[model samples]
Target: MIGRIRGILVEKTPGQALVECSGLGYEVDIPYTTFFHLPDTGQEVTLHTHFAVREDAQSLFGFASRLDRDLFRLLIKVNGVGPKLAAGILSGLDADQFIRCVEARDVNALVKLPGVGKKTAERLLIDMADRIKQLEGQFVPSAGGGSLPEGAVKPVTGSVSDARDEAESALIALGYKPQEAAKAITRVAEEGMSSEDLIRLALRSMIPTK
Candidate 1:
């Protein structure tokens, strides 16, 4: 099952992280929310994981917490929902935020998530309403608290242009078109904002909560 991993973070992008465990480097697909909490490269980090196996390909998805990982498992079981879409959903909203939206039947918020349309949002509302119950007794990590240890993220060394480019790439990876990603990053672009900061702000601007 590959339930968890604790290793040195080798490299990371918006959609993936390379973790070195023992002598092996495992490439883990992670949502943006999980990416947000990743420590700087060379620091130790841990993630809850779900290993997916198909006839031709295998993948490992990582999450910031067990709750998020469990929620992802339940999400993929929904009709028409797959691992990628589930990752996109978590990229927009972490497990706790997603649960609240589901409980409130907030279709607007759900629809704002990448790759989720109105129909999919409504389906998620009806489908995940009960599925979230499965996570009731499990641990619910505080927002932005897991996957990264304190003091591990240092100021990233890069120019504003580099930060903007990285943020745009991240949004595009989350299913936003190139134009949309560029516009969002432009709107939130500020001096001294690192790539991670720009990405977080750009996502919030695109997916504002009610």
Candidate 2:
């Protein structure tokens, strides 16, 4: 089992990365949270990894922090939540916010994200409250955070990969093609932005004016 990877980051996209170690480049799927925190290509990075093996294929999932990896593992244990949805949840909300939503039983907030529904939100609340507390107790939020836990506070200043991914998906769900949304959001980020800001900017980009 590959527990961790420390190597030169060769390439990074919204949901994946290629890390080269000892002449072998390993492609590892990652969540937006991890994608946002990653260093530029060619820099050394360390990632916690989960190795999943099926009859036909082997896959590796990576996380920027231990909390993200732990949450990913816990998410898959919930009924009706697959790896993709788990990644989506992490992409949509940070760990601290997610825990609060579960604790408060906020089905509305949970359903706001793509793919999650009321039933799934209720199940998540019922199935995850206890585990959320356990994980929260173990993590220490970084100083200066308003409410976000340190374990969940991914860097967003320099890189917009994660923000871009979320904005693109949000735009597509609102009625746009995959490529169109991605390009528009990338433009928004390049001009200086956050996910919320990108959402607004992308909306303008999508408008057809005479």
- Tens-digit lDDT track for model 1 on 45-101? 889999999898899999877778888999999998999999999898867678778
Candidate 1: list runs displaced more than 4 Å: 137-161
lDDT of 2 by residue, 14-121 (tens): 678999999999999886667767777888888988887778788899988777778778988999998778877776665666776777677877776667888998
Top-lDDT structure, candidate number: 1
Residue 137, candidate 2: alpha-carbon lDDT: 53
- Compared with the true structure, the alpha-carbon lDDT of candidate 2 equals 0.73
- Model 1: weakest 10-residue lDDT segment is 147-156
Highest TM-score model number: 1
Q: So what's the TM-score on candidate 1?
A: 0.88
Question: What is the lDDT for 197 in model 1?
Answer: 84
Residue 167 displacement (Å), model 2: 5.4
